[model samples]
Target: TKIKNEFPVFKNKVDGKKLIYFDNACTVLKPKSVIEAMNNYYQNLGVCSGDRSSHLLSWRVQELVEQAREKVREFINASSTKEIIWTKNTTEGINLIASSFPFKKPRDEVVLTLLEHHSNLLPFYEQGKRRGFKIRIIVPNKDGSLDLNLFKKIITDKTALVAVTHLSNVTGLIYPIKKIISLAHQKGAKVLVDDAQYIATHREDVQKNQMDFMVFSGHKIGGPTGIGVLYGRESLLNNLFSYNVGGGTVQSVKIHGNNIKVQYLPPPAGFEAGIQDYAGIIGLKAAVNFLEKQNQEEIADYIEKLSHYAFEQLKKIPEIKFLADYQNQIPATLISFYFSDKKVSLYDFNLFLNHELKDYFVAVRCGHHCAQPLHQFFNTSISMRASFFIYNSTKEIDILIQALKDFFNRKK
Candidate 1:
């Protein structure tokens, strides 16, 4: 309850009841500090930030931007700020890497898993089509868990990269990324982890994991949308071909008698080609600072407990068939489940939770949750997801259970 008050969104009533935000996987509610930080940027310094300007506002903006970069670096325990590239979202970062990565065509291969989101899969799939690189897929086990032996068999010296999700959005299963990174390294393949879901409830140490590339969205955390991060090793980032080119990318461009010469800036600036989202960056910094102050370890433990509680509670409902691994510890903060009753559709259940359920709105995600392949693995078309965060509580879970019981009773 104390932590819940930090988010101003809870103050507002939805359909005559308090809002129960269970869609943390899609996007978490922003805290007051993050919102204030963003508003501060617009209100105080609404100017462009780059080398071209020397004015006071521009200098302040530049300082904030760099400070935010440093905060992110510290948050992830990155080696330096040069390794961080600001992007619009995780999708953009994946696309950037897919386009810019040095793929050696027919001989080279990229290893991916069935658990990847469309953002992680499509970029590499499309790139393979253009680059003629072989794409290998690792299928998960029957219960939505990965098999390391299969992964070992799939990854070989020909594999240039192993792109996989740190956590499954559909099943809410946290993959062992550190081990995955080790395996990829053994096979002389770089690893790119889609940390969109994992980073929300866990502390990410890119250095410890030795991750070559990592991508996530600010909105998945407590920051604003339209701002994300792509963390890559400095050397690898410098080697990558530029994804976007525009106003801020190049240091200089000279055109003399139709002979043009251009010198592009280094990694971060080169990758971030356009005028950046200053407010979003500032807001992300504030979000990181907020999380840091709260202590990520404690938050993680709390969320884990809440996840277990939710799992146990949801398991009581016989109709609920969970996609997650319920036999062991539930590492993920979310749970995805489906109904066996053909009469109860995913859409109607989500609708009841969001609007028609006893006047309160229990916000959840419906549909494939962007992991259609995983759904195919489970042999289902769609399911509903209820993801939790720091602000979520056991009381909310009880309410959700009661709501579910009410929903089922009404359906019957």
Candidate 2:
């Protein structure tokens, strides 16, 4: 409740407007606990080389790091802490594994879906282009849901990996991950879930689902930027090869005139190559604490109700088309729409929303939203999206509705 006061962004008005943040689909506002944790990390506990050093201060910082990792492990229910690998963000986590996977076999296939974020797509696509592995793209349902039946057809004995999103960033559709994982495991395929947009918002029981890997971003969930998690199974972690090498990964190295051998540490440390963002990680832990303090079920319900109201109100305008069907129970905080006039470019609509009403809401994104493929299925030229968070209220939705009405009424 007092979170808005801590985030400095809310303190200032834009073009004489009070900022209403609805752009949570892209990133969320951080709470005071997160901010103070970050501040304290540098303001007092700042240090270098968290684990390699022996000094009290350095070890203390390392303790903080481990504590943060434990928080993530507990939050996601990881069987073993060793399985969690820290990355810069969800993008790096996906790419690191995708790029570094040891292609020790003659036949290996990687499966992706159209519902994937680009972070999940391009990495595998690049791997396919470079390494001779077969890449298959599973199609989404007409309603933007993932088609599991389609997955059963493409997965084969040769399939090595399956990477998909737990939730669609654009469509607001949730995928059947447990079923997807079951289907993949039957074919000896490991799955990597892009929880970048899905995690921290939903209730996830990773242990029950038996998911092989899950990755998510910190900034998206109100933690500081430049930090994320890569959760892998213990068996998979043991066999995993690190993509990066630096201070933390190396135990020793032997150099020869023409050959070199570097001894690498095990999974978690081996994968975290360079210097880490200590403060950011600390802040991430606080962010997780703050979220845990709230009731997840209630939060999820609030978002859905707000989303439903926004959708119904938007539908009242005949000159507009919404991107999502109101019937689906995808989280409602985000509602995307378009103007019906042929003369109106999406850019114009976005510009109006961003510039004309910059103060009313702070979180809005315009265009393909890095989800171009999704727009094609919806048959939209472009979209103006308003996202919601715990801070948003129904009154704001009404304000948005009236704004839309005024725009169309004046134009006509």
Candidate 3:
């Protein structure tokens, strides 16, 4: 309850009713501290950083940006700050890797899973198309759990990289990333984890996990948008080609009569091409600070409990069929379900709850959730998801349950 007060969005109401924000998987509500941090940057130190200017504001901005990078490195237990590369979001980070990674045609291969969000899947897919590297998609078990045996069989010496989501955005199931990393390592393959969902509630140690690379969005963890972190092994980052290179990426340029040669900076500087999102970086640092203050283990436990409660409550409704078995030991941060009646439109139901419902405004996501392959695997066109976070409670789940019951009963 006290934590809910920290989020300013809780103060607002929709149609004279309290907002039940169950779309946390899309983005979490920002706290006052994070907002203030961004404002402080704009109000005081709004200047170009990183060799652009030699003024007080620029110096301050540079200092704070590095501070944020260091904080992210520490947050993810990365080996060094050099491993952290700033991007617009997780998609850009993945795209950078896809573009820069050295994939040898006819010999190199990329492996991905069905649990991936579109961000993790598309870049590699497009890259594969261009590079002619073999691309393999690993299918998950019925419960959205990774079939490790399948992975072992699929990943061979030819596999260059194994990219997977640490947590499924649609299913909210946390995958066994460490095991996956170990398996991929055994096959001489590098592993990349999309930690966009996991980073918010779980503790991720890139060093401990031995993952080659990891990416997550700032806004998913109560930070500002347009800022994300891509963590890589320092050695690997230095070796890869910089995808988006410009002013900030290069250290020096030499001009031959007709050809120009450029010397690029190492790791982070080279990877971050343009002027960085100084305010977003500052807000992200504040968010990391906020997360540091909170008991993450407790928050995770709370979210799991709330998810289980929501699952049990939703299961009572005869019209609903859950995408994954929630009763399992695997903890969930969200629950997705489709109506038993195939004729009923998922979008209409979502619209009913989001707009037409008078008792409460429930913000649930309805669609493929950017995981079309996962939906195809499940043989469903679309499903409704109610995701939760630290600010959510059993009371909110109760409201959601009642709203769903009212919607279905009225339809009957």
Instruction: Please report the candidate that would top lDDT against the real structure.
Output: 1
lDDT tens digits by residue: candidate 3, 210-248:
989999999999999999998999989987976998888
Clash number by candidate, in order: 0, 4, 0
RMSD to the hidden true structure, all candidates: 1.4, 2.0, 1.3
Q: What is the C-alpha lDDT profile of model 2 across 110-190, one tens digit per residue?
A: 998877777888888897788777788887766566667888999888889999999777776667899999999998888
Model 3, which residues run further than 4 Å from truth?
Answer: 105-107
Task: Note the Cα lDDT for every prediction shown.
Answer: 0.88, 0.80, 0.88
Ranking according to lDDT, highest score first: 1, 3, 2
- Candidate 2: residue pairs that collide: 20-361, 20-362, 22-387, 23-363
Candidate 1 residue-wise lDDT, 1-412, digit = tens: 8998899999999878789888999998999999999999899888999554788889889999999999999999999999999999999999998999997643389999998999999999998899778789998876777889887898888889999999888878888899888998998889999999988788999999999999999998899999999999999998898789988889899999999999999989988877899999999999999888898888888888888898889889988888755565474688888997866887887777877766578888888988887887887888888888998899989998998888889877
Pairs clashing within candidate 3:
none
Local error of candidate 1 at residue 211 (angstroms)? 0.9
Model 1 scores a C-alpha lDDT of 0.88
After superposition of all CA atoms, the RMSD between model 3 and the true structure is 1.3
User: Which pairs, if any, clash in model 1?
Assistant: none
